[model samples]
Every structure is written in structure tokens, then in C-alpha cells.
Target: MSVYNQPRRRVIQMIMIGMILLIVARLFVLQVVEKKYAKLADANAVSRKVVYPSRGIIFDRKGKSILGNDAMYDLVVIPANAKNIDTAYLCQILNIDKEEYKKRMLTAILKNGRVRQSVFAPLLPPEVFGRLQESMYLFQPGFELVQRQIRSYPYAAAASILGYIGEISPQLLDNEAYKAYQMGDYLGLTGLEKTYENVLMGQRGIQYLVKDNLNRPQGPYENGEFDSAAVAGKNLRLSLDIELQVLGENLMKNKIGSIVAIDPTTGGILAMVSSPTFDPNLLTGSYRSANFSRLYQDTTKPLFNRALQARYPPGSTFKPMIALVALDEGVITPSYGYPCGGAYYGCSRPIRCTHSGGGHAANLRLALANSCNSYFSHVYRLSVDAQKFGGIKIGGMQKWADYMHAFGFGHRIGVDVPGENGGLIPDSAFYNRRYKGSWNSCTSVFLGIGQGEVLLTPLQMANAMCIVANKGYYYIPHFVRSIDNDDTDLLAKYKEKHVVAHISDSAYQTVINGMTDVIERGTGRKAAIEGVRVGGKTGTAENKAIINGVLTAQKDHSMFVAFAPADNPKIAIAVVVENAGFGATYAAPIASLMMEKYLKDSIPAKRNPVVKFLLEANTIPPAMQQKSKLDSLNRKAAATLKNGAGGRTFR
Candidate 1:
């Protein structure tokens, strides 16, 4: 009995000792091991401030700074620290009423819970900042002026391409993609700024400052032991030539359309212009919000990126690709001829040809040079109904569509730019759904001449020209040439070569020769430059839109696609001019001017008249302007149109 009692006593003693050790461990964790509550307790006396690093600079291929940082200030506030401050004087300095001051204070409190700091007024002008800085000490620790950097554009061009930055939205704050960002931070809203945001937005730094009872900053906390330095963002280099971009934008002034130019060798975009572009500076600094609202409400849609988003029928500009597909499929040879009297009579509704001379399409090259509608329509039918794959429904049309897909049609070409539209390229399945599988090649004959079901973006058309210029291979079109200090494989795809149609080089040579003839002696003669050999195609795309609740035919959209220095092509370009009749009249000259500028660095003095005329032409329909509800919209447009040229013959 004595031994059992001894063992029980030892066990009870051990249990008591274990309880004491647990209590000591808990105390150690609370007072020493964990620092969170300690930090919270010291929060009243210590202020942890965030330092935002300057964003990366953007340079053109020639190393000129297109986007750079401008010095600015942000007014920050801590609600709990606000005490004995001169609200009235502060309001006067900020140029805000008392009510607005209270509202802003309440907003800052709501954003940061009265303890942490939040933006009271962001992107303040230098004059306003100077005034605020003079009386800052009167406000104690409640309000502080923090240095900031805002985007500045010296050229004030490429508004759509450069995009803008704005305050982060609550919705974005909740997204995992923006988990690192706070409410007051600014983020890219569109264009290249949005695409390279992660690389451009550098890491934030933290610094701790000791505070007094009155919330005034005393000195660095613990000699800045917990401070962290910010890392600067990596710079970026773009393939865009700002001068070329300015030239394209100037040429597109008072017009409604887009121009996309690419380096055929590297697939780097040389110049991209969406007409009606606003100055990029309008979307920067303190006036961004108001100017943005004005630009957004403008009926001309100055914010719309037509080069990447607008879809149009390829028109006769698509003839070379059709010729490639036919040549690849053995449905037509380079010497294939058609004598349909300048019109395709195979279809129930005859498709007219720009070449009206009898027996004009004596060969495939001759047909392409003359843009004979009858020749292409016959070739399209032959490819879709060839015996190689059963018939249109069984395999022929699908095979044809396969060729289209290989050529980067019916899918986005994956340009580095955002908001690209994969233009439509119809297949057998599409026809099966639209026509209940009752359609034949002749049923969709308009597609043969690029007028029906087949639509393409200006980027896609330019890429197609690259494929032709390179004799079947193309690189993905991209804007940035390289990113400074970046080692990631994010841009690997752009360097890859895509072989489309798998057509022989000889077949491409035939098509290219015909295009050269178009600029030399055919409809696209206006596109020919002085010393440069240019291969080009002119397209007069039929435009139809509903006006006054009735579908009516409007003026044709002028279009042209070209490659220059025909022997060793460098630049491939596509231009579209809305509501402008005849591709040869407007689009061809625009392309020619751009080529001349790119190749020769400036338009020849002899072609100065052509440049002046193009620089001053307005083709927007009068009905469209009258339909705009914007007050004085038509009047403003008319005032600008006064500096432009009048129309000549449609063709």
C-alpha cells in the first residue's frame, strides 16, 4: 500500500510540473516569440509608411522616351492621427469646400480604418502641392505630402496605344490578380500599360517612424531597423517608331479608319493608328477623370482601337491568299485562265469584276493583277468542290477552312497587343448551321472575292501580307522589341515562325508578281513609290448599315494591303478608310505615303501635294454626324473639316 501511494504521488507531481512548463511556454510566445500583437500595441507610437517606387520608363526603338515620369505629390491622411488641425485653412489650400473636406476625411477613414494612411487627394499639381507644403506642419501628423510620379507624354500621340492608369477599383482589389495592391494604388487600364503592368509596377518599400502623443512623427523607429528599400521597375523598349506613328495619325486625321504597319522580317509593329485618337496627355494627371469622361462620350469614339478591333471584309485585298490556297490545293495553276466575260456567271447572281474587258483573266497572275471577280469565284468553287475530299459537306469545305486556319484566319494571330478580334472565317459547320447544310460553293460565292462571311482585322491583313512577303512563313506581330532586365520567356512565342498554307515559294512568287503589277500598272498604281518597288492590292469593300431604321447602302470602305522593296520586303502594311469610295483613291495613296515615309524617312518633295491632300481629307458620312446627339458635335467636326480637302472622283 505504501509503494502504490508513492507512485501516485510521483505521477501527480509530474502532472503539476508539466502544467507549469506549459504556462511558461505560453508566456514566452505572448511576450517574446510572436511580434504581431507587439507591433499592434506599438502601432499607436509607430507608423509604418509605404513607399511606392517610380514606374518603368518606355522607349521607342530609337531609344527616345515616349512615356516618362513627371514629378507630382499625393496628399495622404491618417484619421486617428488627425487632431487640432486647421480644417478651414486646409480646405482653402486644397480649394475644396468644408463639406468636401469632411467627405474626403470620412472617405480616408473608411479606406484605412482611421489608423493606417490613405490618399486624401492624389496627383496634385505642383502649384497646389506648393501651397499645401507651406502649411503642412500646421496639420501635424494628420496629413502628409508624399512624393509621387505620374505618367507624362511629350509627343501626346498614341493615346489608344499607350493607354492610361487609374485608381484601383474595389472589384479589382478583391481579385487574386490584384491581391498585392491596396485601394489607393493606381493600375494600368488598357493597352501596353496593362499588358506589361507587372513588370512596370515595381515593389513597394516599408519604413517605420516613431510618433508622439499628438501623432506628430518624432524620428525613425529603432533607427530604421525594419525599413525595406523599394526596387525600381524594369524599363521597356518598343518597336513603334513614334515619328511614323505621328505620321500615320496625321494622315488618318478627319477620317474614320485604321492603319497597321509591321516589319515583315521581325513582325514588330512599325506604326499603328486608329483615327480620331485623342492626345494621350488628356488621360494623365489630375484632369484625367474629366477628360476621360469627355473622350468617352465623344460620338466619334476617339477611344476605340480600330486597328485591332474593327472587322471588315477583306475585299479584293484577300485575292492573294485565295490564290495561295487554290495553288496549294492543285485546284488552280499559275497559268489557270477564265473567260467569263468579266463577270462570274456560275452563280445565280453574277458577281461583277473591276476588270470589265472581255477575256481579261488570261492567266492566274493576270486575273489577280486585274482583280477579276469571275476568275477568283471560279477558283473558289473549284477548291471547295474538288474530288480530293468527297464534296463541300463531306470534306471539301472543311479542308478549305483548314487552309484558312493555317493562314491565321478564323483565329486571332496572337499579336502582343490586347483587344484583338479573331475575324470570321466560315467553315462547313457554320454553313450547316446557317443554311441547314444546303449551301454550296456557289451559294457563298461572295466569299470568293472577300465580300461575305470572311472578315479580317487590319492586323490580320497585315500578317497575311507578311506571310506572302516571306513566301509562306510569318512571325507573330508584336509591339515591344525587348524588355530591359527581363529574362522571362513571356515573349518567346513572338519569335516563333508560323508557316501557313504550306504553299510553294513559286506559287507565292506568282501572286507577288501580280501584286507588283497592281501597283505598277493596275488599280493600285497610286500606291507605287518613287524608288521603292511595292506590291499592293486595292479593296473597295461594300459598306451597308441601318440608317433611320432602314438598311441602306453607304459609301464603300477604301482598303489596301502592301509590301515594299518587293525584292527584299521589309514593311507590310494594311490601311482602311471608312465611307471613302474606291481603294485606289484613298487607301492606296495613304499606304504609298506611309511606305515612302518609312523607306525614305520622309515623303519625297514631289509627293508633298499628295501628303498635304491626305492630311486634310474627311470621309465621315454627313448622316452619321447629324445622327450624333452630342451638342455642337457636327459643328466641331465641320470646323476641323474646314482644314481638309474635298472629294474627287469616287474611283
Candidate 2:
């Protein structure tokens, strides 16, 4: 009887212990794991706000800040706490009607839950900020003015390169990559900003504020304990020459064109300019939203970065590449010559040569110097229809396309900047698709002169020059030279040497000699510098576009590509002037001026007259110029922007 009673007592003891353990576990979950009560308590005595760090500054090669931050304020609200507030006065300061105010408030509530903050009015004008700061107490814990930063361009150049920032979009917020972002957070929307967003965005910090019974914050809660400091974004150093960028922009003004300059040694972009560019300062602070729409819809299309976006036939500037391919394939030697009587008679439709005289195509260098269309057209036929590869049927067209691909055509170069267009590079497969597999080499002979179906962006053309300048290897073109305290591997790819085609050194040297001759005694005479040896090519690319549903030849686009100090090449450039007639006229002179300016650091007094003429040269068509609205917009908004947007100055 005693043993049985002891076993029953042990069972009773185990039951009691189990009940106590369950009670303790439930208490731990309620006190530590859950936050409902903690939030309720926090609402009563403390307020939490985000402290955004200053965005990264972008500096040119000369250590001048091209893009920097400016102090601004955002009026934010917590929907659940914004009760019995002066909505009417708030709308008045925001310069919005009551209906618009209601729409924003509802949007804020729906985007963020009732507890978190959403931007009520962002990047406020200085006058509005001052008024809101004075009346902030009336809104109590519901609303507050939080300090933030907006981007400013000190040089007011490179608008397309530096890009702009805007509130995180609805689509981005839903992605896993952007999970840390809230509804009102700002991020880079385009260009370099969008490319290096992670490095430039910085880490956001949270600060807890102590508040009184009336829900007014007195000061920091607990002397800043439990607060995290905001880490400012790392500064970015770029290879851009600020002065060169400005000069390029000025040179292309009132004209539809683009210019891209590169450092051949490293593939760092020196200056990239698209004509009709506006001040980058226009896309910052309070007026950003309004100004963006106008700039986007402007008649001249200033927002488009034609240097990296627009597609154009390389024209005669492409002849060098063609010659290289021919020489690389053993189809032609440096001394190979062609007989020309103005036009190439090999194709069914004769292709006319700019140089119709005899002996102009006597040799490779002479033919290149003369830019003989008949010579290059023959070379293209020989390369693609070579009997060694069983002609175009077996591997000829594909081999040519492969060489083009190795030279960075028909694909994204994976530049640091986003939105690079991979211009078309036709292959046998492409022609098969287009011509249903019945095309012949002569049928596409126009490609030999960089016309017909061939198209290329200015960046790609500029990169092609770098290949010739570097003798066979190239680095990926990029803006970022270095980042302050950078811990990531973002720039590793740009630093790697990308070697292409095993063509002999002799071939490259021969071509370089011909291109150098172009500046010395050929069509690119305008590209010659006083003391420096420059190699260049001039292109009068025929322009054809659909006009009223018909593909019409409107006018020729002027193009020039050059590399300076050919013996020790440092800078390479490509310039494209739309509808500006012959390449030797506008494009060659522009490239020549830039080369001179960079090599000497200033155009000598002798060239000042040439500069003046180009600066005043109005190349824009009369009808298109009449339709442009930028002149009126600049006149009206320039003064207003300087005074209204955060009251900060742009230099």
C-alpha cells in the first residue's frame, strides 16, 4: 500500500511541474516576442523618426564636385495619429486644394500601414518649409518636418550621366531587392545614380525622441541611447574632365548630335554630351516632378542621351573596322590595291565612290586616305565571299559577325550605367531571318561602307576607336574611377583587360598608319592638331527615316572618330552631327577642336576665330528650331528655380 501511494504522489508532482513550465513559456512570448503592447507604450511617450544620410557626391577627375547634396525638408505624417489637425492650413502651405490633400492623405494611409510615416509633402520650397516649421507644434505627434537631402549639379553639366533621384516607385518597393525601402524613400532613377544605387544610397538610421503628455517631442529619448547613427554614402571619383564635358556641350548646342570621348588607356569616359542638354539642377528639389515632365516632352528631346542611346550608321568612320576585318582574314594585305572608275561594278547596283579619280585606290593607305568607297566595297565582298571558308553559304557571314561581336557590337558592353542599347550587327542568321535565307554577299554590299542595315550607338563607335587605339585590347567603358572606402567588387569587371581577335600586330600598325595619314593628308585634314599626331576618320553617313510612312533620305549626318598623339594615344573620341552635311565640315572640326583643347589644355589664340564661328553656327533646321520650347521654359523657370527650390545656389 505504501509503494502504490508513493507512485501516485510522483505522478501528481509531474503534472504540477508541467503546468508551471507552460505558464512561464506563455509569459515569455507575451513580454519579449510580441510588440503590440510595446508599440502602444511607445506611442504614448516616444516618437521614432528616420534620419536619412547625405547621398554620395560625384567628383570629376579634377576633384570638383559635379553632383552633390543640398539640405531640404520633407513634411511627413502618421495616418493613425493625424487626427483633429489643421488640414486646411496644411493644404494652403502646400499650395494644393483640399481635394488633392485628401487624395494624398488616403494614398499615404494605403501605401503604409496606419503606424508608419509617409511623405505628406516632399522637397518643400523654402517658404513652405519655414511656414510648416513655425506651425509644426499644432500637428503634434501626427506630423513633423524631417530633414533630407536633394541632389545638385555644381557644373550643371552631365545631366544624362549623373541622372536624378526620385521617391522609390511602387513597383520597386514590392521587389525583394528593395524590401528595405519605404513608400517615401528616395533612390536613383537613372544614369550613374541608378547604376551605383547600392553604393550611393547609404544606410538609413532611426532616432527616438522623448515627448510630453501633449504629444510634443522635447528632445532625444534617453540621451540618444538605442539610436543608430546614419552612415553617409561613399563618395565616387569619376574620370570625367569637367571642362571637357562643358566644351563638348557648348560645341553641340542648338544642334542635334552627340559626342563621346574616352581615355584609351583605361576606357574611362572623359566627356559624353548630347546636344540641347539643360541644367541638371532642374531635376532637383520642389520643382523636380513638374520639370521632369516638361524636359521629357520637349520638342528637341534633351532628355535622351544620344551618345549611348541613338543608333546611326557609322558611315565612312566604319571603313577602318572593315579594313581591319579584311586584313585579319588575309583577304587583303596592307599593300593590296583596287582599280576604281568612281563606282564598284562588282555588285548588281553599282556603289558610287566619293573619289572617282584613278590611282586614289592604288594601295591600302592611299585608298583609306582617299576614303574610296569602291575599294572598301570590294574588300567587303572579298572577306564575306572568301573561297577559303566555302563562301557565304558555309561560314563566311558568321565569321564576319563573330569578329564584329568580339569588337563589342550587337550586345551590351555591361557599362556601369544602365540602359545601354546593343546596336544591330547582322550575321548569316539575321540575314536568313530577314531575307528568308536567300541573301547573297553582294545583296548586302552597302554594309561595307557602314550603310544599309548596319547601325551603331556613339558609345559603341567610341569603344571601337579605343580598340584601334589600344592595338587589340580594351577595358569596359565606365564612369567610376574609384569609390571612397568601397568594400564591394562592383568595379572589378571594368578593370579587367578584354582582348579580342588574334590579328597580327602588323595589321593594326598598318591601319593606324592609314588613319594617321587621314589627318595628315586625307579627308580628316580638319582633325589635325598643331604639334600632336592624330589618327582619324570622317564620315558623311546618309540619313534615312520614315517620313509620313515612307523611308525618305532627308540629309546626311556628319561623323568623325579620332585618337590623338597616335604614337602614345591617350584620348579617343567619336562625334556625330545629325543632318549637318559632310563629315569634314562640322564633325571633323568639332573632333579636331576637342583634341586640341585636351592636349594643350586650351585652344591657342589662333583657333579662337574657329571656335567663335562654331559657337555661333546655327545648325538646327529652321522649322525644328521654331518648334522648340526650351528657350521659353528656360527664361521663365531659371529665376524661379534659383529662388524657390530650397533657396540653394547652383554654380
Candidate 3:
């Protein structure tokens, strides 16, 4: 009986000892290892504050900060600390009643649980901030003014490309990636801001301060040993030419279209204008929400970045790519010729040519220069229906689609900006899905002429021009030229060279020579610049839209793609004007003016008339805007381009 009692006593003793150890370990963790509860404990006699660093500045090629930061104030409140203060005067300064103040206090309590701080009044206007600063101490520890840096665009241009920032949403706060961010924190919403958020958002700092019984900050806790300094966001240098951007925006004023210009040598975007752009300042500071609501509801869609999103047909601009594919596949030679009285009879429906009598389709370069529809249609049939590819279904069509992919189609080209759309490039599988596996190349023959089943963003067209300009290789189009005070992998991918499949240099020359002729003596003659060789292609993309439950044939979208100083190509540009009559009429001239500006640094004074007429032209369909919807800010900018010569011919 004694032995059994001893064993039970030992077991009870061991259990008691184990429970005591567990309790001790938890106490140790709460006291030292984990700082969460320690901070809570510190809250009684200490104030922990967050210090936000200034956001990175965005500079153009000239080192001018087009997208910069301007200091603003936020009124922060800790619900538990708010006591025995002038609630009425505070409300009066904020222009809110007692009920509204109570409502805000309740909201702050719910957000931060009565202990932590939350934003009460954010992005205060200059006058309100001045009034509040005069008597802020009267509010005691419950409220404080915090200085924050908000974005400012001095040029007030590139709204779509620079993008906007807004307070973090509850959805974003719940995300694991954003767990560290508070509810009132702002984050990039679109464009380059969204794309480079990680680098642009610097590290936040924490400071611990001793507080008096009245909740006033007495001094640094433990002599400031625990405080962390804030780190400023890394700055970025862009390839964008803001002056060029402004000019493009001015020319694209009162229109529905896009202009994408790139440095063909480096694949750096020189200027990108999504017409109907609003002032970037509209999306900043205290008025951001109200201004955004207005812009979002506008009929012209001033917020949309058309340069990287609009999916318009490449039109005759695609003829050169077709010629490249044909030349690469051994289906056609540089000297290949066809006899076309007026139309191509090979397909079920006749495809008409601009040049009817005969010699238009006489050779590859000649056909390209003339933009003969019959010639490219015949070449498309020959490549897809050729025996070497085992006919269209077996291999040919997919190969053609492969070439299209190599040219940066059918997928995002990964430009440094966000919201880029990979426009449609109908492959065999696509045809198989749409036509259920029973269709011929002629069924999509218009694709050969850049009219059917092939849609591309202006950026894609511009990038394709870079590929042509570089002969076979291209760098991904990007806005950032360099990152300042940083050694990171931020720009690594943009630095890589993307090479298309090996194609003969001679084949590229043939296509390039024809494009040069296009500016010299063909459809794109208007695109030529004095003493500078130019290569250009004009396009008229047929379009249709649904209106009141009816599919109506809208006016063709005028388009043009070009490369300047043709031999040693410096710039490549693509301009698209929606609902504009002919490519040569609107798009060609727009591209021409832009190219001239980029190459000569200014449009020759002689071409002032054409620039003036285009600047004042309103090409947006009447249905899109019954009256001009151009914002007053942009209208003022556009007015700068109005001081030129009189009206001139479109071509």
C-alpha cells in the first residue's frame, strides 16, 4: 500500500512541475521574446508613432521631376487618448458638425480598436491646415498633425501613364502582402506607379516616445535607442520626353486615339499619349476622389490609356509583317511578282488593290511601297497552303502565328507600365475553336492584308517597328532608363535583348527599303522629313460597333507605323486615330509630325500649317461627344499648339 501511494504522489508532482514550466515559458515570451504585448503595455506611458518617408521622384530623360512629391497634412486620432478636448472647435475647423465629429470618432475607434491611431482628416487643404496648426495643442494627445508627401505633376501630363494613388482598401489590407500597411495608407492604383510599387514605396519607421499623464510626448523612450529612421523611396529616371509627351497630347487633343513612340535602338518609350487624357493633378491631394468620380463618368473615357489598351486592327500597317513571314518561309522572294488587273481572284471574295492596271504587284518592295492588297493576299495563300508546311491545318497556319508571336503579338510585351493589353492574334487553334476545325487561310485571308482576326495595341505596333528597325532583335519597350541610388534587379528584364527567329538581313532590307519608299513616294509621303530618311506604312483598319442593338460600320480607324533615319533607325512610332477616314489623311500626318519633332527636336517651321490643323482637328465620333469634352486644363495645353500657320491638307 505504501509503494502504490509513493508512485501516485510522484506522478502528481511531475504533472504540477510541467504545468509550472509551461506558465513560466509563456510569461517569458510575453515579457521579452514577443514585443506585441510589450508595445500594448507601453501604450499607458509611451507613444509609438509611424514616420512615413517621401515617395520617390520620377524624372524624365532631362532629370526634371515631372512626377514629384508635395507635402500635405493629415489629422490623426487615437480614440482612447481623445478626452477632455474642444470637440466643437475641432469640428468647426474641419467644417463638420458635432454629429459628424462623433461619427468620425466612432469610425476611428472601430478601425483601430480605441488604442491605435487612424486618420481623421486626410490631405487637408492649405487653408484648413493653417487654421488647425494655429490651435492643434488645444486638442491634446487625442489628435496630432502628420505631414505626408502627395504626388504632384508640374507638367500635368501623362496622367494615364503616371497613374494615381489612393487609400488602401479593406481588401488590400487583408492581403498577406500588405499586412504591414495601415488602413489610411495610400498605394499606387495604376500605370508605372502600380508596376514599380515595391521600389517606389519606401520602408516606414517606428519611434517610441515617453508621454506625460496628459498624453503629451514628453521625450524619447530610453534615450531613443529603440527608434528606427525612415528610409526615403528610391528615385527613378525615365526615358519619356515630357515635352514630346505634351506635344503628342496636344496633337491628340479632341480625338479618340493613341500615339506610342519608342527609341528603336534601346526600346525605350519616348512618348505615349492616350488621347482624352486629363491633368494628372486631378488625381492628387484632397480633391482626388471628387475629380476621379467626374473623370470616370465622362463619356470620352479620359481615364483610359488607349496607347497600351485599345485593340484596333493593324490594317495595311501589317502588310510588311506578312511580307516578312513570306520572305522567311521561302514562299516569296524580294522579286516575287503577280499580275492583278484590279482584284485578287484566288479567294471566294475578291480583294481589291489600290493600284489596278498592272505593275503594282510587280515585286515585293514595289508591292509594299504601293500597299497593293492583291499582292499580300496571294502571298498569304501561298505560305499557308504551301506543301512544305503540310497545308494550313497541319503546320503552316501555326507557323504563321508563331511568327506573329515572335513579333510580340498574342501576349503582353511586358512594358514597365501596367494595364497593357495583349491584343488578339488569331492562330490555327483559334480558328479551330471559332470555325470548329474546318477553315482555310482564305477564310481569314483579310489577315494577310492586316484587316481580319488580327488586333494590336498601339504599343505592340510600336514594338514591332523596333523589331523591324533592329532587323531581327528588339528590347522590350519600357519607360525607366535607370533607377537612382539602387543596385537591384528592378531593370534587369528590360535590359535583356529579345531576338526574333533568324531571318535574312537582305529580306529585312527589302522590306525596309519599301517602307522608305512609302515616305519618299508612296501612301505615306506625308510622313517624310527633310534630309532624314524615313520608313512608314499607312493603314485603314475597318471597324464596327454596336449602337442601339445594331451593328453599324463605323468609319475606319486611321493608323500609321514608322521608323526615322531609316538606315540607322532612332525612333519608331505608331499613331492611331479612331473613326478617321484614311490612314494617309490623319494617322500618317500625325506620325509624321511626331517623328519630325523627335528627330529635329522641333517641327520645321514650314510644316507649321499641318501641325496646326491636326492640333485643332476633332476626330472623335460625334456620338462619343455631342460637344467637345476636352477638359479645360488640356484645352489650355492644346492652345499652345494653336499659334501656327493656317489649315493644310491632311496628306
Candidate 4:
């Protein structure tokens, strides 16, 4: 019995040992065989570290810096994980009110679902972070100071073109594309910043770091081998010439207008100067919101991108486009003649020509050279008449309007710049809406001479000149020349041509001859550049306003469009001076000065004896001096024409 009892006791002991062994094996699997799973569980108790990538740089075509980034520190608090934080002390140190602190805390909880830690608000100016550092002991263990990139536009004054950056809103983060971005990430808000965000924003990277129970980072878990470094965003090389841009800004001082200059051959924008421009740098950093709101509320609207947005009547500048359309459509041959005789069709209004007193009968070539309204009126009427045979009339007013559309008038130029307005080109549909289908071509006759319901942006006007320069095709206008840091493949795509309008080579030469004559002996003589064979047209559109229940014409909008080295044009420009009367008097001279500056590195000196005489002729009152000189010039021109003498030659 003793021996049996001993064996049973041994077996019981063996069973106990087997149970212990099984427990040990289970512990080994949970701790050693699956240590990664256990480590993940521990990680849930610690904090996370996120590294943000730096934004890209924006450079001028010459590689000069326009916009770049600077390092900043953001005070990030994890509301859910923040424990026993001294709220009063934290608010005081961060220079925030208690209400603001509570609001941010609640927003973080709601945005991050209270399940994980998230940043409550961004720390701006970096000084806020310095204050937070001093009060770190009062903050929650999970709180952190994360480094961020703040956008900086160094040039400042190029705000309209460079644009500004702002914090991303809640809606933007909901999109799948922006899911990777955390709250408080800065985004390009306007201008080129918003236009090329995709190329300018670089790839994000990740780093795995170990953290303690207090949520403090303990460097990299695997000696930094597992971390991925962020790639800086690619830089953009814009086609804008900074020197010329500054020059243009200076020239536009105390004025209200826009100047747009482009290289006809490449469609490269050289200078896009809008008067009353604001500093882009003012809209950067901590004071961005306050300054932006102030600028936006200003009456002048300095933020308005006038170069691509403002639309106005092409005025007399429309004459050249009308001539080209008439010549191309064969509404009238170049030799078709008409008598200005002060008016056309014997209308009671007498549609007076710009010619002094009353003008003489003129052929098409001479009419275009003199900008004869009667000649253009005859051609416009003939094109609109269905009874006129052998006149290339397919659709009457509609067809003529289509030809203008083909010239890029009354349309957007599809420039790479954002917020481009498609200036109104009143068509049959537009008239139908306004007149309820009762308006006829005669009802909108003012459109024939480039006024009334016909509007165009400076960009479009310049592009029209480019179309003439190209003799048919036009490359889509763009600001970015290339991505500075990108491979050649990305830039190759921009080199492709985007043709807006196409005309026959023969028609182009004919139109070129007309423009050339305009500078040689017409209203655009003021815009002529010596030795360069420049061609251009001038316009002065009446500005009418309602006064005491009557439409009263007051100031005029001056305008000019020109191309240089007429035979092989390199530059095309459009100048519009609001409320400045007579295109030849104001806009033409400005355009000429700009052209001379661009082509010859200086404005052509005032060599004309008449110009010199006018400058020195101070006997007349200041108010009447300009009018007196203009009247004198008109008399001189009329005397020369009456005597059958050649027009004054520009030396």
C-alpha cells in the first residue's frame, strides 16, 4: 500500500509539472515569439512624432528668389492626453485668453475624435513657442513643439502674382487627397502659390521614434535606419523679369492702370504691373490675417489682379482688329475707298472722325493709316448686309463676330495665370438676352468700332498683337517658364504650342502692312521706334455716365497695342490708361517708352521739334496747354495734307 501511494503522488506531481510547462510556453509565445504585437500595445500608451516637409521656393526667370520658406515652431497640445495641465498658466504664457484656450482644446478633441492626440492651434511668430518652452513644466506631458515651414515672399510687392498662403480649413482636410496633412498645415491661397501647389508641395516622409510613458521621444528606435527624410518641394522658375517689374511699378506710381508686356515669340510674360499693388510679404507670417482683411476691405482693391481680370472697351485700339477682320473676310479690298466727310450714311449724329475739323475721302490703306471711322463703318455695314454679294458674307453679324472671336477678342486668353476673366464678347445670344430678341446689328453698331458690349483684358489685347506677330498661330500665354528643381521632362510639356487663333500667312502680311502704315503716318506715330520699324494702333474710347437722367460723355480711356521690329517681331505690348484722353497722347507715349526701354535699354530721347516745342511752350495755362498743343499739331498736320506735302517723318 505504501509503494502504490508513492507512485500515485509522483503521477500527481508530474501532472502539476505538465500544467506549469504549458503555462510557460504560452507566456513565451505572447512575450518573445510575438514581441512586435506586444510592443504595439505599449506604443498606444505613448505619443507620436510627426515631421512636416518644407515648402518649395519661387524664383524669377533669372533665378532670383521671390518666395521661399523659413522654419517656425508650433505649440501643439494633445487635449485627450493632456493631464493635470495648469490651464491658467499655459494661457498666460502662450499669450492666449482662457476662452481661446478652451475653444482650441474643444476643437482638437472634436477634430481628432478624442481617440488620439492632435494639435489644438498653430504657434505663429516663433516667439509663442519660446514662451511655451519657458512654461513647459505647466503643460501636459503629451504637449510638443513641432517645427513647421512658414511661407515668405521676399519681394513682397509681387503679391498679385506670387499670391499668399494660409492655414487649411476643415473642409480641405476631409478630402482624401489631403488626408495625410494634419490640422494647421499652411496652403497656397492665391496667385501662383495656389496655381502650382501640386508641383510646389514636396513629398512627405516618416520617422519611427521610441517614446516613453510620459510621451517624450527617445530618438530613433533603430539607430535612424528606418526613418525616411522628407524631400523639399520643387522650385519654380517664372518668366517675369524682376528688374522690368520693378521698373514698371515705379513708372506706374501715382497712376491707376495696368501694364502687360510679353515676348511675342515665346509668349513669355516679361512684366505684369498692376497699379496699387500690395506687398505679398505683408500677407505672410503672424500678421497675415489682419493685414489681408485690411487690404481686402480697402477701396482701391490693391489685391485685384488687373492684368488678367480688368476688362474695358478696346476703344480705338479695336480699329486695328477691325481692319484685320475686314481684310481677312474680304468685306472690302485694301484699295476700297470712302470719304470721311465728318460722318457716314448721313446719320444725324455725324460719327465724327478723329481727323481735325472734317476729314477727306480716303482709300482703305490710307483710311486704316488715318484710322478713318467712315471707311471702317462702310466695311462693317457691307459685311453685316446680306444683300452685298462677293463680299465673303456667310453669317452676317454673327460671322463677323466669329472672326473677332477667332482673333481672341471678347474671350479669355487661357493664360496659365489664375482668375483670368473671359471678357464679354456680345454675340447674338447676348443681344437676345438684353433686347429679348428684338435687337439687330444696327442696334449695336458701336461694336463695329470696338465699343459697346465689347470688352477685353490687357492680357487678351497683348495676345491679339502676338497673333498678328506670329502671322497666324499664338502660343498660350504662361508665367512659369520651368520647374527649377524638376527634371527636363516636366518642363517639356509647357513647350507645346496651344494655338488660340490661326490665319493665312498672306492675310497676316497684309494686316502687318496696315499696322506698319499706322505708325508711319497715322494716330500711332507717337509709338514708333526708330530703326526698329514698329507698328501699332491707338484708341480713345469715350467714357459716358448718367448725369441728371442724361448720358454725358466725360473722360476717355486711352489705349495702345504695338509690336516691335515689325518684320520679325519679338515683343508685343498693350497699354491702357484709364481716364486719360486720346490713345496717341497718353497710352501711345507710355507704350513707346516701354518698348524703347525694353529694346534699346532706354526711352528714345524727345528729338521731335514739335515735342520739344510743346515741352518748352509754357505761355499757355496748364489746363489749356495740352489742348493748345494738340490743336496746333492738328493744324500743322492738316496744312501738310492740304499742301500735298509728306507727313512728318520720325527720325
lDDT of 4 by residue, 294-325 (tens): 66665556678888899888876777677666
| lDDT to native, each model | 0.84, 0.87, 0.85, 0.70
Better of 1 and 3 by lDDT: 3
- Cα lDDT of model 2 by residue, 134-208, tens digit: 878888678888888898666668988999899997899889999988878899999999988988999999898
Give the candidate order by descending TM-score: 2, 3, 1, 4
- Write candidate 3's Cα lDDT for 1-651 as tens digits: 688699899999999999999999999999989876786576678767788888888999888888777778889988898899999899999999999999999988877679877889988877889998888778968898887878867787888988988888778988998887887777888988888787788988888878776556778887777789889888889999999999998898888899999998888999999988887776777767766777787889888889988898899999999999999989889999999888889978777765669887789888888899888888998888888989999998988889999999989999988888999998888999999987997898988889878889999999999999899989999999998888888788888999997888888999999999888888899888889999989998899889899989988899999998899999999999999878998889888888888888888789989988998898877766865444653444334324320001000
Q: For model 3, what is the error of residue 268's alpha carbon versus the real structure, in angstroms, after optimal superposition?
A: 1.2
* Residue 39, candidate 2: C-alpha displacement in angstroms: 11
lDDT of 1: 0.84
Error of 2 at 48 (Å): 0.5
Off by over 4 Å in 2: 1-43, 113-115, 635-651
Model 2 per-residue lDDT at 585: 91
Clash pairs of candidate 1? none
Clashing pairs in 4: 156-280
Give candidate 4 misplaced runs (Cα > 4 Å): 1-46, 107-123, 134-137, 210-218, 346-349, 356-361, 386-394, 436-439, 485-494, 498-502, 544-554, 601-651
Error of 1 at 425 (Å): 0.8
C-alpha RMSD of each candidate structure in angstroms: 6.0, 3.7, 5.6, 13.0
